[model samples]
Target chain A: MAGSELTNIKSPRVKAARRLTKRAFRDRDRSFLAEGPQAVREALALDGVVVELFATAEAETRHADLVAAATAAGVPLLRASGEVMAELAQTVTPQGLLAVCRFVHVPLETAVTPGSTLVAVLAHVRDPGNAGTVLRTADAAGADAVVFTDASVDPYNGKCVRASAGSLFHLPVTTGAGAGRVAQHLKDSGLRVLAADGAGELTLDDVDLSGPTAWIFGNEAWGLPEDILALADEVVRVPIHGRAESLNLATAAAVCLYASARSQRTAPAGVRRPAPAG
Target chain B: MAGSELTNIKSPRVKAARRLTKRAFRDRDRSFLAEGPQAVREALALDGVVVELFATAEAETRHADLVAAATAAGVPLLRASGEVMAELAQTVTPQGLLAVCRFVHVPLETAVTPGSTLVAVLAHVRDPGNAGTVLRTADAAGADAVVFTDASVDPYNGKCVRASAGSLFHLPVTTGAGAGRVAQHLKDSGLRVLAADGAGELTLDDVDLSGPTAWIFGNEAWGLPEDILALADEVVRVPIHGRAESLNLATAAAVCLYASARSQRTAPAGVRRPAPAG
Candidate 1:
């Protein structure tokens, strides 16, 4: 509401939005792009998370509710030309809405406090799409947080932000930590750290997931190395019951996290179903 | 081994391979392209599936074992130039090998026999990646087969083939059929037909997945239409216990199919854990 119509694509505000596309600029500004109406709406819902809102004149009329909500939330809404919006947005057909939001991730120490029932740890995950899907899956499963090891893809990457489908705004995500340190931290917080590997000794069904647990996933191409696998309390695999070689990273994470979610929701207190007979 | 070196990118074999990139060409020829060593290797393992194998001269030396296997299998292995190979491949850096395989999908009737315990039905799924991932997930879960309804993307699309990770060769996939017809056929096979919807009366946990079942998944954007959801015996939602709105199509399919796989594997015949009290 305070900002004028930003028609020039080279304007500082538009340039800033474009800069957020790179990891260096995002880290420096501690802000990232949340594009499309759904993502922007979700970001606006989070108090103080949305720093600035940009909408093309058409988008303002099309998403009147979102514009009104952003205005009511005291977010500075900047009107931009279609060309300016297109320059700032990633999609082939720009959705006409973009939000610059402060990094919503909390410190790992604060997120993994006691009573953290479920968490997802991604180690050396290089694909932004997989990383984002895992984050979305983790959020859907009610995980307390997600931690990306130092070698993982930037969780704020444009493709990742798009793949997350707005779930990135729903939960705390931590990045740039070592797998060993993250594993130790989770274990220190009284959570069982389980590494998901293709060749694990125990099947996912064999694990007791009702207690506080940290599910560790690895890279898409090459999975967790031996050293990282050793950091977990146990290594488990989602059983490949058929001829297919393996599940994709995100699907594997979904199965693992949902299994834990189902178990924790059903099992009474610390009691869980015994591992099924092989 | 019998074919001479093909240095020209305009050779008939290379032209045919290039044409397979289009759906119309693939359908008319009833052949699809399988790129990379893993996919080519898997294609060779299936007797008579690999019609023609092409490799760069450098690839021939690198993949001696594959060449030997193909030679022993009596498949015509054509040697091509790097330029020809690059033109044939979709990747920025071609893997140096490609295979033309006849469509391996079988008749839906044969796939949905009475003995079939688990199957995946995808209706109106437009994303080639999501469709392929679902196929891979179904295969990994040991489902009997996967069926893509009429509106679905061609399962043989290059992106779909890549996302399937060779699982496309592992199981029978049926396509170009109506959703209603597929649903009716599955029901007639004495399998419980369950439609997966984000908004459904029953959660996936409440369903009896231990029995023979056909799980139906909808499109990536707009989910299953009302008519399709109405055709199923029951509509079940994967429980979203967190703030995330919904699971991606592929992840939702993995969760559903694996739930069925785990249930069918763990539960005794006609006996399963009672639905957890919610």
Candidate 2:
């Protein structure tokens, strides 16, 4: 397996995979690439999400389990040379394994159920890394859903997917809705919508968040616009105790989501497991 | 004051500034360049921090207040052409201002005072962006001090300084110390030391952080090594309520620091101000 596959950077399959790097092509095909063993494994774990798997011969040997899993799931595995993998990979250094997966976003109605305790709505967020980070943070906080608003960076962006650290598959993600529409949807789902803005009326310490809630986080530089802030049930700011002007967007999201997670303490959803007893 | 000055990209000043990009050179000169108007302005706010300032004609006109500040502080001002500004700048597009400033780290004893309620220890964090964001988050959370241990990235790293968004000048930062020594220093200062590791024994929810607390965070990838974790009074994990594996380093730092800030509720340090009684 290590020496069999010939290098073919110009192959049609490779060319097709290469096109997914752009958002337009990814949208047209309704598919995107998940690079590295971690993301490939996560993609394989989800039902019908993974369309195909690609790995270098060396990687195929090193990650036989992923190859085996793909085979078991009836997903075809393509063994490519390092050169081909380099072509398929978006990173400067390709990790030798990548998966082309179907878009996994659910509709807003399906993303947030009535029993949802917390949700993170990324509205007007432009940075892919920040968007992905907040997605990971939301999943860690056990938010029921994460919404990427129309103005937000595509969840399928390569950098965002990598920054998510396999969290792209962990929780429900709803996309393409506007901030006001997402807020309304969350409100309709019986969740209190709170906008996290620097000019918010109340500080995080002064707010009560123990109920079903949705947090709206905005762009990294200019926070939520006035119209989006107006739709929220309340606007809250994370208190700043030093001379720093503001908190980073993802950091702010983590603080808000965890505060809600702390207050809610929903057990069955999952918590970071404790160390095994001695 | 502006257009009259010719750009000398090969001049001793520009070449010397360029060399400061490397840590060895920065340490040798006991100085680093703070680029952009925001950073330069913050550096000017501190006495003896700003040694000299460089600007292009356009930027000088745009930020006359900064020029006034530097003039009032008696700091040398150098006008340069766009080419010279680009030569000294680390970013792809130069922001047209740069300040060569002295190292700002304090000793462990000076950084974490007796009455300090919250502190952040970045033990072996290697990513400059993560380190810088954590520093900014620590500042926003009203942390008393932020420490960059021996294995940590240099706070003077160009990316770290920019990522800090001027919070680098807002708080006390102690650098080049080992994690264990820093831990001992915090313990001796009457603060409880908690190391944040994925394998941490107690979850944040199960712990009490209301008192004087110092949080130790490790490398982005491998987390804290065992020897360093053993040095902490306790190892705490932020709960991951969903299927996500872990939180990002900067995000974890934010949650932990803000938790302490909320519990401690120090009034005089200045919270991000409320909307000015509008």
Docking band of candidate 2: medium
Residue-wise C-alpha lDDT for candidate 1, range A71-90, written one tens digit per residue: 99888899998889889998
- Candidate 2 clash pair list: none
After superposing candidate 1 on the true structure, give the runs of residues whose Cα lies further than 4 Å from its correct spot: A2-4, A270-278, B2-4, B270-278
lDDT digits (tens) for residues B1-278 of candidate 1: 64678888887778988999999999999999999898998888899999888988888999999989998988888888888888888888888889999998888898777778899998988999898899889999999999988888998999899888898888888888898889888877778899999988999889878888899999867888999999999999999988888999999999999999999898885574332222
lDDT of 2 at B75: 85
DockQ of each: 0.79, 0.77
In model 1, what lDDT does residue B198 have?
93
Write one digit per residue (lDDT tens) for candidate 2, span A104-160: 999998898776768999998899999999999999999899999998999999999
Model 1 chain B: lowest-lDDT 10 consecutive positions: B269-278
Off by over 4 Å in 2: A1-6, A266-278, B1-6, B266-278
Clashing pairs in 1: A1-A77
